[model samples]
Each structure stands twice: as structure tokens, then as C-alpha cells.
Target: MATSSFSSFILIFSLLSFCAIAIPEPRPASWSSKTFGPDGPWNAVEVVIGGVGQNRTAVFPGHAWHSWFTSTDYCFLTSSDHCNDAGGYPLRNSGSSRVSMEFLQPAQEWMAGVRVAGEDGFMYLDDMDLLFKGDNTDYITKTSLAIISDQMLALPNGTQYPALLGCLSLGSPEANQTFVEVPGPNLNGTMIPWPLAKRGATPSSSFGLHIGSGITVARMQGSLFWGGYDRNRVVGDVLALDGGFYEPILLKNIAITVVKGASPFAFPSTSKPGLLAQGNSSLSSSAGLPIVIDPCSPYLSLPRSTCDAIASHLPVTYCPNLGLYIWDMTSPKTTQILTSASALSFTLPGGTNTQTLTIHVPFRHLNLTLSKPLALAPTQYFPCYTSSGTRASVLGRAFLQDAFLSANWESSRVWLAQAPGPNIQPGSNPVGILPGDTAIQSGGNDWATSWDGFWTPLSEKQANGTEGIPAPAPVGAGNKEGEGLSAGAKAGISIGVAFFAAGLIGLGILLWRRGWIGPSTSGFARQESEIALEGRHSVEMETAMPNSSRGGGWGPVEVAGTSVRDPIPLGEVDGTSSSSSKKGLATSGRHVRSLHALA
Candidate 1:
């Protein structure tokens, strides 16, 4: 009897120990960030669309575009050949392999009008994947990766163009990006960071983006930190501002500082010239032209007078056809301001509650290279374009190159600081953020003292002693996950589990013989309701289309993505920190919100 009892004890102990060691507990907020995209500028990711077998397709926009722009890859999901020709976009064999939004459902019928880079398309709820290419691809699925489809025949001239690239819009309220689909896809566009926050994968839904300076000099290197910020990127005093969820970001005024060679820039102005005021340059932060800092804006769309004012001071001339300031190589001042330390600064005067932040952009950094399609050849042009048709005076991708933006989404607080060059620190200085009102952790290398104020350019090694071609993404690259246990370890665990199971059976037999165990019956019943979310929330009404279905807006907009009434799930995104656990994202049943009553 003692021997049998001892054997039973050993089995139970071993099984319990295995369970304790193998099962991971809930992890502390974990953050995983990686660099993405192809050589040249832009951030690229694998967008897999279509779920119905042959119709399912994957498109990597980085490889499709023959030209270079700011950070991002873009493509239209419309099934028309005209869309391919419209934007100088490469032909995709009559939209055969295009990501045709296989996840969309017509029965639920949720659609919204979407306009991008002058091209108009209807946005739809999609069950697709947004994979961030890294050492392992990190992804959020059953989410809206923005599958916009358009019929060229519906355009004013049937000649509209697609945007050069698309953006992973990280800011905004969760309801703005998409709504739940019946048997609904899991997450939405705005909710990308939310799952990380909810799963304890990140501290909060707050993320920071530093789109490094000088496309050629930046080497397409940047950081998108979730639940944290790269402290090495911040310089001097942090300009903290409130209100990221609704009101457009307003600045006191723009301050331009230039060298002797530049004319208009040499004299700092409190306000823009007369004609520029037509576009809202004269408006104050209280109202007027709100400054929208978006990574999607490929260039600096300043007011016309602002663009002309700056152009008058440089060796660049505006090309109306392309809407770009072509650099004049023959100009005597070209060598001066282009090479000299001239800076344009954006000032946001500190209110009693907000601290002032002045971000300086180097004049040299404004000079970007243009390739075929957008340009005839390798031409140098100023990225500042006239904000003729935009909703506001916009600081596009160009501005982000010098600004480090961090938003505490839970509290709706935003802070912008000067972004330091790559070598300002030895390593990618990522610091975890505490949830809510508490901001990001401080950096490992404090660069407040060493900050050069964009006066002198940062140092860089000339690749191959000349401007080298940007690196291409590795083959089979769009995968995401932590370095998990190897196959051998997994096999071992399986075998061990089986052995444990056999031992339990033997223990049961022994206990039964000793009358220490008895067979009992118990039943568990679980029922889950698949919830569908449907509705529409619009911010700005589209001109002439008072009834236009809208999905997103630069300002505060809530877009209800039609979702599956049945439960949809967001699979777990593995946390990278040691404190994290194996708990993946919650299943569809846990997060079903009934949004069927929206107008």
C-alpha cells in the first residue's frame, strides 16, 4: 500500500510541476518593434487580401511601385485595369492578383466613400491581415487593413490617380477606423494598438513614430514603438500638448530661420503673407487652418504663400505640372542654402497648461530625390507643396522626419519633440510606457545636451562610397513572433505530455484498486453568441455628398465598419518582454459591442 501511494504521489507531483512550468501566466506589458519596407523611402508590410481560395491574394506594394516616396506602400483593391494606369501604378494583369478584399460581405452591406491622393474609392469592412515585417512578422487580423475599391468610371474624368503610398494610421478613436462584421472580423483600423493594450502586450494603445530625416541620409531607418517611445530620438524640452482624439492640432505660428543666401527665410515672420492667408495661414490655433501632422501626406502641403515665400528664398522653382519645387542647379545660392545650415522651425507657444515645442527642420533635409513616374529622372525637388486642395494646412511626412510624436491615447495627450539622428545613441533606445496618464519611460542616452538644433547635419557613412541602392526586403520576410521554443523542444513537450498522461492512467488504476478513487460524472455547457456590429459615424460631411458614407477623417470621425454578428476573434500577438504570458488576444465572444442602432 505504501509503494502504490508513493508512486501516485510522484505522478501527481510531476504533472503539477510540468503544468506550473509550461503554462505562462499573464505577462506585464510587452513591446516588440521592428524596421520594415524596401530600400529607398517608405514603410512596407505584407497585406494579404481575399479569403476565398484562388481569389485570395497577397500584395507587397513596396515591390510594385517603381518610384520612391516618403514612408508607406499603397495600392488600390479595385478590380479595374484603369486604376493601374491612373496612378502610374504598375499593371497587375487586370487586377487578377490584386488584394480584392476577399473578406468583404455584401449581405452586411457596409461601405463608405474614401478619397486618397485625389483618387476616390469606397472603403469596406474587411477580414484581412496587416503584417509588420520584422525578425518575425507581427500582425492583427479580423481587422480593417483599409481595403478601398474604386470604379474609375465614377470619377469626374475617369482619370483620377491612386496615392503614391498608403499609411498605417495609428492615431484616432477606435470607432473611427472600422466596425465589426457579422461572424465579424476581430479588430478594426484604429483598434490596432488597442488589442496590445488590452492583452497586456503593451502598456496602452499609445504608440510613437519617428520618421528619420533625409530620405537618402535616413537610409529608410525609423522606429514605430508601441506602448513606448525611443528616448534616444527626443531632444531638448518635450513640447507636450493635449487633445489628440478630436480637435485638429493647431500651432501659434511657423518660424523660418535661414542663412544669408535665402531671402524670405532670413526674415522670420509672425504670420504668412496675404495670398497664403487664403488657405488659412492667417488663422490662429483657436480655429482657422488646423495643422494636421500625418505620415500619409507625402510632402509638406503648406499654404500657397508659405510655399512661394520659402521658394523665393531658395534655388528651387515651383513646377505647377508636378506641384513640386524643382531645385535649380544653376542658381548661385543653390550650393549655399542647400549645403549651409538653414532651418525652418514650427513653434507652438506654451499655454498655461501646455509647454512650448519648437521643431527645427534642416533646409538640406527638405531636398529629396524623385524618380520615374513622379519625375522624369533622378531630380532633386523641395517636398513643400502648396496646400491648394487639402482640408487644412498640412505638415505631411516631411515634418515627421524631424519630429518625434508620442500620444497617450487613453488620456488624449500628445507630445512632440525633436527627433535625434540615428547615431545619437548606440542602440535603438526603447523604453516601456506606463499605462494611462503616465507617459513613456526615459531614454538610456540622454541627448538634451548633445542636441545640435538641426544646425549641423548628422553624420552618415556613404554606402559603397556613393549613394547606394536601398536594400530590398529579405525573401520570406513578412513573419512575426517571438523566438519561441524550437521544433525539437515542442516535440519533447508533446512526448512528455503523453508520458504524463500514461502515468496518470496508471495512477488512476492504482488508486481505484486501493479504493482511493472513484469514477464520477460532471458536464459543462458553454454557449456563445456571435455579435455583429453595424453603423456609420461621420465627422466632416463630404461636399455635394451629404449622404456620402464615410469611414475616416483627419479630424475626429467615427466610422462604423460593418462586422459579423457572429463572434469574431483577434488571435494573440505574442508579447516580447519576459514578463509577458502566452495569453493571446481574446476570442470574438468577449468583446462584442452592439452597434446596430447608428444612423
Candidate 2:
């Protein structure tokens, strides 16, 4: 009946499947964002291991040398669709100096994006814990043996587990082992193409067979389960199985305070915040470990060109001129700027609580919001005194615990929304301007002055006339000289006396030639009379010359071409000729003399 019920539930679940798959939210840490925050899906999350003044020894789960909070061993695990098998391994702390980790089964695993700093000044990831939710409580072993890949183990059926992927060996005092052979149509499951099985196999061991093309295999450990409560109980807090609702759990307190000889808004103390205790600087918590802020990280939202300019003026590790202001959570309207040393310390009204240390970091330019809070880790000492790397800013846990903040990218304005704890006193709008924005604001006037008088779009103008391109002049307009010349322009004009005399002479010539009046009555009367007398003399000469000419034209005549008549008199020629000439001589033949001589 139990098997039938389980089958029915599986069928129902398959039928109710939706085409769209829901994506999981990012883990609580801000560092996870490097891969999966607002960015998207990620392959891994890394973390640093090392608590406040505590460390691990054996590098295994139960055999650990130190664990201040819990007595029993707690092994960290990782899982997804990818891994050697499905098993996980234990994470070790730094104080013990053990550097290697081991896994039990062919389980899927992931790295925690945690960073740990050594006394020598090196920073790196330590270990990660797996996220799982399930209950498998029936366990009978106190030893809780985990088989490593290098170890040799024999199975009940002539097979060895560590041959390919290792197995975790657990001893159960009870006779009934939780081994359920899921028998059904194995149409879609993980398939392995291993050529040979291991040497020993056991009936009590769990084995899974795979059958599909895309299916894969992984290993997982048993989760503690709860049944009937007994006086002699071996169970403990099941963080993975608890589903009850509770009040908000205090993670860490954040504050913004002023510090002398350090960046404004100093971080929490080095010894606090049970994770990543490298030194007192700026840091945050994500994936259960401290994530120190590297202000120089390229992932910061500052523009590339501006960042380059700033890097040239200041060292990559430190910038003394930089400042910040933040508002605490308690006083929403009160903002405090960490401008000087005296304003650094924060004292809450009810006394500050260290647990509520996480603060939300808002990035105005990236359009990103970080829910994870920043923390301050211990300072690391390097071999040389040249510590040139980036140090975390004052926006660490201690400062975040006491402030609220808002920033505007367009205006380059940042506002501290409120004060948090009682120690964080209230103030007016204690906000900051980003360095690049400040530089632009200060240099705007100079830039505008340089670009003035040049043609540009009309939209660029400042309310106070401090920035932007100036307005253009009207079309068809020139400078001062052009305006004055335009006022006197006219269609007609006259000049002085000499010019007037020339004009009158031209008028008289035009009237005479155009026949406006007779020449006799025109100007210069005596000249007109002489011209008429000359015309009469020419007419009389023409008439008298025609009368003098006789009927026959004077010329030399000859018979049979002996001689041509004398040249004809020009006076008897056609009237088109200007004048007629008198007859001078005539000849009868070539040998004949003139007519007068012949007579």
C-alpha cells in the first residue's frame, strides 16, 4: 500500500508539470553576485573558512580539532547536476594548517566563493557547504565513515566502490537498512558505461542504474530524519529540514562612521563577525564567509575613462581624499557624513547589537541592489611592509549597522537616508559626491568658457548659465558693423555740383538726338544757321552740273575696235554716286590726238 501511494503521488506530479521552469534566487551573499546575483546563473560559489579566533585540525567532519559552537562534527557538502559521484566532503579551518579535502561518493559538488587571508597576506578560497533539503533520518552509526577516492572498499557483490567513485561506509545497529530498489520502467535515468564492476558488492549497499542518453549520476549523503522521540536521542538541529517560520535572524550590524588616518566609514573590528578575520578593514558576508572589498576591482560600476584618470592621481590601494556619508536604519531622515575624526564613533541609544550588522549596499549606476551586508575582517601582515593591494573601505559591518543610503547617478548625488543604532548620531543630509562627478562639476565653467561662441545645438544650457553650450544668434545676422550699414541703404541718391553739371550735358545731347525740338530753335542758334547755308550750297552745285552736261557723253569713238570712245563723263553716271565730274578729254583712236588738237 505504501508503494502504491508513492507511485500515485509521482504520477500526479508528472501530470502537473509546467513547461516553464522556475529559476532559484541568488544566495544571500553579495559575492555570489560575481557569478549569479543580478547577473544570472552560475557554475560555482566560493568561500573562505576561518572563524573569530578559531580553526580546524583534522580536515574531516567528526574528527575536527576545534569547533567552538558545536561539539559533533559537521561535514560541508556541495551538489548540482555535475560531480564525481553524489557525495560531499568536510571543510577544514585554517588555524590547523591542513590544506587538502576529500570526498565520499560520486556526488555533485560546488566551491563556495569565500576568501580567506593568511597571516602572510595571501587571500584565497577555503571550502564550501552544500545546500540541500530532504529527510533521511534512519541512521545507526556513530563512527559515520566516509570513503575517499584513494581508499579501497569491498562491496557485498564482489565489487569495489573506490575503483571508480568512492563510497561512504555507515554502520547501522538496526536490522532494517533503508535500501529501496525502485522497480519500474527505467526509461529516463543516468547511465554509466564502465567496463568492469568493482571486486566486492554488498546487499546492504545502495546502487542506482541509469538508462537514458542525457542522464547523469551523482552521490549524496543521508540527511538526519526524526521519528518517535526517545530519551536516548542521537539527533541534533536539522538545518536542512526545518520549515517553521521565525522572526528575522540577526546576521550582522552595519554602521557608517568617521575614522582618522583611514577611509571614512571605517569597517568592523578585526576580531568580530565569526568569518574572515584577516584585519580591520572593509568587508562583507556572502555564502557564509567574509568577502573583503577590493575597491580596485574592475567589477565596480565606475566608468572606465574616469577610473583611469583617478588611478593616475591616486594609488590603487589608497586615496586619502575620498569620503562617504550614510544614514543609519533607526533615524531614517538623519544622515551623517564621516568627514572628520570626531564624528567617527557611533553609540546607539539602546546600545549597539553586533548581530544586526548587515547593511544593504545600493549602487546607483549599475542599477544593482545588494542585500548582503559588508563586514570587517582582521588585518593580514605580509612579509614586506609595502602592502600595495586594495584595502576594504569603511562601509564594513560596523559602519553599515548604523546607516541607510541613497544615491543618484544622474546628479552625482548621494543621500544618507537614516541613522541605524543609538551610537550612530543623526545629522543633516550627509551625502557624498563621486570623485569623477565632482571633477566634472568643478570644471564645467572652464569647459563652457573654452567652447563659447562656437556653433552647437541649442539644447545645452544651464539654469544658472554655469554649464552647457551657449544659445545661437538669429539667422542672416552679423556682428555690430553689419547692423549699422543696413539702416542707410536706399534705391536712389545724388552728389555735389560737379556731378550735376555732367548730368545736364548728357540731358541736352539726348534731347537733340531724339528730335524733341527743331535744330533752328535749339541751343547755339548761330551754329544752326551756318549748317543750313552749307546744305543750300551743296544742292546748287548738283543742279548746275547736270545742266552743263549735253545729250552725248564725251568719249573716244572708233570703228571696228580700232579705239574705244573717250572715257564717259562721271557727271552723267547713276545718281547713287556722291558727285559728278566735268568732261576733260576725248580720243577717236590710239594714234589720234585729243579732240581739241584734232579740231
Please report how far candidate 2 places residue 183 from its true position, in Å. Answer: 11
Instruction: Quote the lDDT for 159 in model 2.
Output: 29
Q: Which residue runs of candidate 2 sit more than 4 Å off their true CA positions?
A: 1-57, 60-111, 114-599
lDDT of residue 346 for candidate 1? 76
How displaced is residue 574 in candidate 1, in Å? 38
TM-score of each candidate? 0.58, 0.15
Off by over 4 Å in 1: 1-40, 43-137, 149-160, 175-190, 218-220, 258-289, 350-354, 441-553, 561-599
lDDT of 1 at 279: 34
CA shift at 344, candidate 2, in angstroms?
Answer: 15
Clashes of each: 31, 91
Give the range where candidate 2 is weakest over 10 consecutive residues by summed lDDT. Answer: 209-218
